[model samples]
Target: MRSSDVSAGLAEGAGQAAAERIRDAAILRYGRDGFAVGLRAVGADAGVTAGLVLHYFGSKEGLRRACDAYVLSVIRSEKLKATTGGPAVVIAQLAEVEEYAPIALYALRSLQAGGELAIEFMEQMCADALEYLEAGVAQGLLKPSRDPVARARYLATQAMGSLLLWVSLHPEFHEIDDFRKELRQLWDEIALPALELFSEGLFVDRTMLDEYLMYVCDPPAGDAKP
Candidate 1:
């Protein structure tokens, strides 16, 4: 390759690196500050000029969209890794859960913002959940679902809803100045109960499920109950 080509390639690589740095910084900042955070703050956090942030992302909204996509991709990758990597990997990840604080906070902020973008992000999450959940079923780590897609969507919605509700109920959670600390505290509180419910289940028997399926879902022919 020509010297100019090599220099241009190097410059392009540097620009991409800078853009990723900015995006990551924005993720942490927005996670802490929410959607109302200014671009200058993001740039400062990223160690770049506000003009550079705009140059790469065009506007605050554009930067937010980029953050959303990046956060989603990171979550999808991590979840897939956990699903496929077996119990040891899952345990190891849980040991280092602090690493996920920024991503989790960003996701919570996105959902809390509430708009078209949030809805789109959530739909993508559900789709990704379905993919990984199917992988878990294939690996025998998770039970097979009669309606896998709906199950995946339901699980995603339930998880998000539960977290949001917890945060809402404990307004002091938002008073924490450090995002990582806040996430750690939240995880410490919820992990045991969530695991118990997921593993042991809430119901003692299948009677409720049987009735729901037989009566509510697909009732027997000529059953005049309705």
Candidate 2:
């Protein structure tokens, strides 16, 4: 609980049991802290030396890579099926779930801070999204003039800004954490319609888009029962 608790994941050498045990400890600690995402604190709480955690992970960045994988595991174990409705649907489904918030916030914060691991993760996700956008345009689901990269940037910016706003406005979400489910629903469900409207003909609806962005850009409005 103390600031000194800042440490890394498990050390370099150990058996699978030890690594798994360390990982389990980290997850437990994270949940206890209401899902405060920290590789160091996780390591400390796991009862492993910071050096050991670093040894296993190579660095805090490395630990994040591992944590990200663990999060994915959670998604899979939970049978998080990809939605049939395309990107908006998929994202909306992800957003509606409460479990995704802590990791989502952690990921967004690290990405904004330009954390190498987070950057890599975002880059990969964006690249994947770009492929989808480009294909959408080609298939006439979106505007041909649209730049997939630009749209991806817009989405990234919006998502990151949303996370920051939520963190700033709703400290209770941090107090109890687990804000991801509701937050994702808002982000993935309600806002996804607007994102879908980003297609060719719909792109010109600046008023609608602006309204959506305003909500995303501001957090106090998060309390609104829209």
For 1-226, candidate 1 gives per-residue lDDT tens digits of: 9999999999999999999999999988887778898989999989999999999999988998999999989988888888778878877877787888788878988999999999999999999999998898788777777777888899889888876776677555442255567666777787788779978999999789777877776544442221
TM-score of each: 0.89, 0.53
lDDT of 1 at 86: 86
CA lDDT, every model vs. true structure: 0.84, 0.55
Q: What digit string (tens of lDDT, one per residue) describes model 2 on residues 16-86?
A: 55666666665445533533466667767677777778777787656656666675455333322331235
lDDT for residue 212 in candidate 1, whole number 0-100: 81
- Off-target runs (Cα >4 Å) in candidate 2 are 1-40, 44-51, 65-96, 112-124, 135-145, 175-178, 181-189, 192-226
Quick one: best TM-score, which candidate? 1
**Models, CA RMSD each:** 4.4, 12.3
Candidate 1, number of clashes = 0
Worst 10 contiguous positions by lDDT, candidate 1: 217-226
